[model samples]
Target: MTRTEELFLALRQQIVEGKIPHGHKISEPELANQFQVSRSTLRDALARLKSIGLLVSQPNVGYSVISLSTEHLMEIFYVREALEGMACRLAASNITQEQLQNLRDLLESHESSVQLKSGVAYIQEERDLDFHFVIVQASHNPMLIDLLCEKLYFLVRMYRYQFGMVSDRAKRAFFEHQHIVHALSVGDGELAEFLMRRHISASRDNVERNLLVNKGVIS
Candidate 1:
C-alpha cells in the first residue's frame, strides 16, 4: 500500500477501535511527527477519515473525531431498522444460492467464534462475519447497499467498539439469524423483512435499556 493508504488504515483502526477518544481534536503536526509522514500525506489520511464519517473538519478548528451520542445512536439504529428490513425483503427475492451459502458459512463461523469466546458475540471484531453486511449485499440494491454498507455500517461498528457492545441475546440472535436466512431461502420476502426489523429493533431496545441503566435513569 501507498503511504497515504497505510496511514489511513492505521488511523482508521485506532479511531474505530476507540483508541483515540471521541471528539478528540486531531493535531496535524503531532500526527505527522508521530507517524513520520509529510504534511501532505497526513492531510490525505485525515481527508480519508473524514470521508468515512470518523472525523469531522471545520474551517478553522481543524479536525475532531466524530463523537456519537445516545440520540445519534438511536437515530442510526432507527434508520438501519427500516433500511435493512427493506434490504432483507429484497434479498429474499434477489439472493442467489451462492450468497445463501456464503451467509450460512458466515453463521457457522460465528457460531464457532461465539463458542470459543465463551459465548461472547464475535460480530464486533470480524468484518467478514458481519451478518448485516452480508445480508445487505444480497439485497442487490445499489442505493441501499451504498447507504448501509458505505455510509452507516461503520458508524454502527464505531458505536459497538466504543461501548464494548455485546448483545445479551447472543443465543437468541443466532436463532433469529437462522430464521431470517430460512425465510430468504424460501423467498418469503414479508417474513424476512419482519424478522429483520424485529431483530434490529431488539438490538436498539437493548442498547437503550443499557444506556438508561448506566445513567441510573432506571434501577
Candidate 2:
C-alpha cells in the first residue's frame, strides 16, 4: 500500500481499537510526526477515515474520533440487520463443515462464560462480534464482508465499548447466536436470516429503550 493508505490504516486501527479513545481531539502535528508524514498527507488520511465514520470533523475543533449516540447505535444496527441477516442467509448454504464446527465451539465457549456469570464484562461484546464476523465472512460475498467487517464492526465495537453490555443482553445474545448457528448448520437459509434480523432488531430496541430516549439521528 501507499504511504497514505498505510497512515490511514494505522490511524483507523488506533481509533477503532480505542487507543485514541472516542471524542478525543486528534492532533495533526503529533500524528504527522508519529506517522512520519507531512500535515497535508495526514489530513488526507484523516479525511478518508472520516468518510468511513471512524472520525468526525468539526468546524472549529478539527477532527476527533466519532462519539456514540443512541441514534448512531440505531443506524448501525439497522445496517447490520440488513447486511448480516443476508450474510447469515448466504452462510446457511455456503458455510462449510469446519465453519459449523467453529460456531459450535464458539457457542460452547459462550456457554461457559454464561455459567461463570461474567457476562457484563464487556469482553463478551468483543467475543460476540467475532462470532458475527465469522458468519459475515462465510457469506462469500466480498462487498458484503468488507462493509460489515471492515467498516460497520469498527463502529459497532466503539458503541459496545462505550455503552457497555449488561448480563441480560449478553445472555440473550448468546442464545440468539446459538439459534442462528443451528439454523445455518441445518442449511435453513430463511430461518437463519429471520433469526439474525430479529437478533439485531432486539439489540437495537434495547439500546433505544434504555440508552437513547428518542434522540433521532443528526444529519
User: Which numbered prediction scores highest in TM-score against the true structure?
Assistant: 1
Off by over 4 Å in 2: 1-10, 17-21, 34-41, 44-48, 58-62, 114-122, 125-129, 212-219
Q: In model 2, how large is the Cα lDDT of residue 133?
A: 86
Candidate 1 C-alpha lDDT tens digits along 152-189? 77777888887874656777788889999999999999
Q: Which lDDT values do the candidates have, in the order given?
A: 0.86, 0.80
Against the true structure, whose lDDT is highest?
Answer: 1
Candidate 1's TM-score reads 0.91
Candidate 2, residue 184: the lDDT equals 95
Q: How many steric clashes does model 2 contain?
A: 0
Clashes of each: 0, 0
RMSD of 2: 3.9
Off by over 4 Å in 1: 114-124, 216-219
Alpha carbon lDDT of residue 180, candidate 1?
98
